[model samples]
Target: MSNIIGIGGSIHDFASCLLIDKQMNAIEDERITRVRHAINSSNPCQPSLQYCLNWAGLQLEDIDTIIANDDLLQVIDPHVYPDIVLVNHHLTHAYSTFFTSPFEEAAILVLDGAGSKLSGTNGDIRETTTYAYGNKNDVTVINRVFGDLKGKNYVTKSETLMSNSIGEFYRAIAENLELGWLVGPGKVMGLSSYGASFGDDRFISEMMSCIKLLPEGQFKININGEKGLIDKFFQIRQNYHKKEDPFRIDAAIAHAGQVVLEKVLFHTLDYLSTKIQTKNLCLAGGVALNSLVNGKIPFLTKFKNVHVFFAPGDSGTAIGASIWGYLNNSNQTDDLIRFHSGPFLGRPYSSDEIVTALNSIGLTYTQPVDLYHQVAHLLSRGRTVAWYQGSSEFGPRALGNRSILADPRNSLMRDHINSNIKHREWFRPLAPAVLDSTTAVYFDAHCLSHWMQFVWHVRKKFHKILPSITHVDGGARVQSVSKDENPSFYTLLENFQQITGIPILLNTSFNIKGEPIVETPYEAIHAFLESQIDVLVLGEFLVVKKFDLTFKSPI
Candidate 1:
């Protein structure tokens, strides 16, 4: 019974995870504190580790090996006791993707804002390392080696390093757009849907010009140096807003341009495929979160299979770090195959705890055995419900367990949820949690996205029907809920289907903008009172906040 603990603390999203004998037992992040991009903070991991250990019914002493995602031995102050094993950030990211993917062999891609650099006497350089574990029925190994993309093997090796990057460009574009300063690339993706084509020739020329101006490798131009670039790219938006009929022509053009860049990525992979000759492709890093790029893999790449770990961002480094530690310390062949699907490795709540929380708040509620029917009725009545159950998820997504539920039939619900409930940007679209079996009926994608990590085009026939969750580009980030993946969530969808003839529900993270997903019932109640959310369901207890009698809305 090997017990390994993983800890990550780099720029933002400090996190930790525990795996017992290769089975993921627990995971959590620091962002839950409502502190945006909290990194290496003391409050994040101490309690999280305690909670994880408790969930596994073990103590800290039970842990055989501790894996530190970042180089804590070097960065952290002395006196911190764990004295963890160190794992390279990129290797962990690669392992997290490769280990979790369903495919036996795949091309792995890891992209991030930036990774730690190992200083060579020659100069600063980017590295590309690959590790292969021997085949276990559940897990297979292809190769394991590490090399610098620069220096001796420069040309052939350079491809390995360049292939992993592309994210820096997106980040620069995001900064130029005046979106949120840190990690706002996702906003650029959302905004791209509004752009229009400016003719293929002109578009390609402009994009190529921009790429050419970019500093080579990791050398990024200062934000001030790139102001002119921003002005040029955004000219279309300024012009469009002045027109009588405003359209997202610029956005559409940008979207098309991004697609073209993604093709470059595919081309790079095609080149790599000639040597690796593996059908499976594994991707990690923040860039791997781009569902559009991920969705395009099957059609664009030479590899027949592609797999991306759920938390491909920096937060996932904790898990990757730990796994690397285990493999290295055990000095055993990488025989582990299957990883547990439940990212709900966070703290759990007991019924007594729920009861205590309700009583402390002086809330009136009834425990219902038929939770599905009860919650479905509230949603059907046009009430937004906060659903909290079991352990919290590991990744940024709330999944079903810690999600806010709403009826998708109402178009106004989208605006209401965004402005009044979630208080997020209007352009951001909500996600859909649909019964896994019915995904094919409504979406164009064939994969089952239990993690809500992929975007699929909503069938034209269902666009209007599910408008609240569908993006302007007719795509929806979808979580296909299965009984095997989450039984309670699955049953809720089943019951909702029985009542409304729709197997899908509008699912968004159970938090307002600028806050992490609610980790406790008290937090859920506080969010409910502060926001437009009408109903709160934690475990079996359902509480409805009493709003001002004069408050009224179409939703």
Candidate 2:
């Protein structure tokens, strides 16, 4: 009954979502521009907006309403479209997770660096933490914590605004190590496990003093105290040739931060459950991306069900905006509709396009009769395959559609992929895509991490068998693949299981370090050639690259 486009994001992760009646399509601007986080504030949202429109086969005029977060005004002028509906940033985030979730009613928690400017008695404040409850179509805010950081400009203000942010606290630790804020949190998360061996507990304890945990899950930061600690122990000096070792002070700091983050999240969720009294909980915003903390929520919190969609960061705000528009303007008072069918909302490429890209690249490919079995055979033999299929996923993860697959049974596979394929820090861990039925058999958690949002412990018996996917802490970010959600990926896993008595594969994003996941066939082919990937599966056509087995050094 309605056609709406929802735009969300601030200076980074700019994205757009199109909702025509109940159907939806979304894309992130960084995927199109090939820039991580779409770093430029001046960069228009046209690319992402246009992609949604094109995917829906509609024009701008066809949309009945345009919904966007108030922060997006920095990118697009609201005056140009005077009727555009602008919603608060944290509210949009709440809408994104609660609506797509299967829960009819659930508690929503939004944690980010900062949200839209909020009214404050002292001065304007930014929202860093929010608690809300969504019942049917109605979502009501229960509580919110505002950031006290103040300045004239956005950049200067955001730094202080995030002082009370757990995500910011984690990122600050990573930035202190020169890993940068964008990808640093994950890198630090991986490095934290190494701390127990080479960590400094005194330093970690001193760092913990910078935070004061208040009642009801709120935290007040002693920024001055934290800065003094950082200046004394974390400052990098000039003429430093090599990066710090992961087993030294860096690991200790990461470990301490990781523990603190878990404590903060658990403390907050414990209080939220008391107020909402709901069996279901929904999480959004940047802080929700920490799978290690997320994995432990079910056991730690009163909530029986935890739902985190594929795209939970700022990019997901677009989906939330669209949901808000439909609920408010479509003449339905209490309609709760789930519009997502997994994270495969991006546009899909046709076989013709795949053929053309391969031809143009002057690479010979074979149209395999049974693509799944052939790829399974290669993977079982210790070959790395870049698997490209259907529409790309809409999140930071690669969910099989755009993934690098290898045998998890190979202990050396982790090192090989990190060094040769991803070109990332060795400390980073790879994830696993396992059959849905066999997930409980291999992992020790009860939550459904189908979107790879939570980390689960690998069973003790299987730890040595699946070393490539297992992290240093004996945990693996597991993606439970169901036949209904994705048949092709499921069939491939089934085939791999039949060939080798294992139902798991080491899965990582299909792109190298510092690159957005490959969007087009040409980009995929280019990445396939640039790296030491053994095989490339583009649709049904298979392209093989002759590479030496010495690189793998099979164990």
Best by lDDT: 2
Name the weakest run of 10 consecutive residues (lDDT summed) in model 2: 150-159
Over the full model, what C-alpha lDDT does candidate 2 score relative to the true structure? 0.82
In terms of TM-score, the best-performing candidate is 2
Error of 2 at 101 (Å): 1.2
Q: Rate the local accuracy (lDDT) of all candidates.
A: 0.67, 0.82
Candidate 1: count of backbone clashes, pairs at least 3 residues apart or interchain: 23
Clashing pairs in 2: none
Q: Write the per-residue lDDT of candidate 2 for residues 1-555, one digit (tens) a residue.
A: 688999878878988888878787888998899888888756556789989888777888888998888877766777655389999998999999988899999999998877887654433467788989988878999888766553222222224425577766777677766677878888888888777445445456666777778887687644323343234235431112245543566777778778877777777898899899888999999888889888888888898799986788888899899989988876765455666567888898999999999999899899989989999988988999999999899879999899999999998899999998889888889999999998999999776678898999999999888889988788999999989888889999999999988898889999977789999999899899999999999989899997664554254
**TM-scores of all predicted structures:** 0.84, 0.93
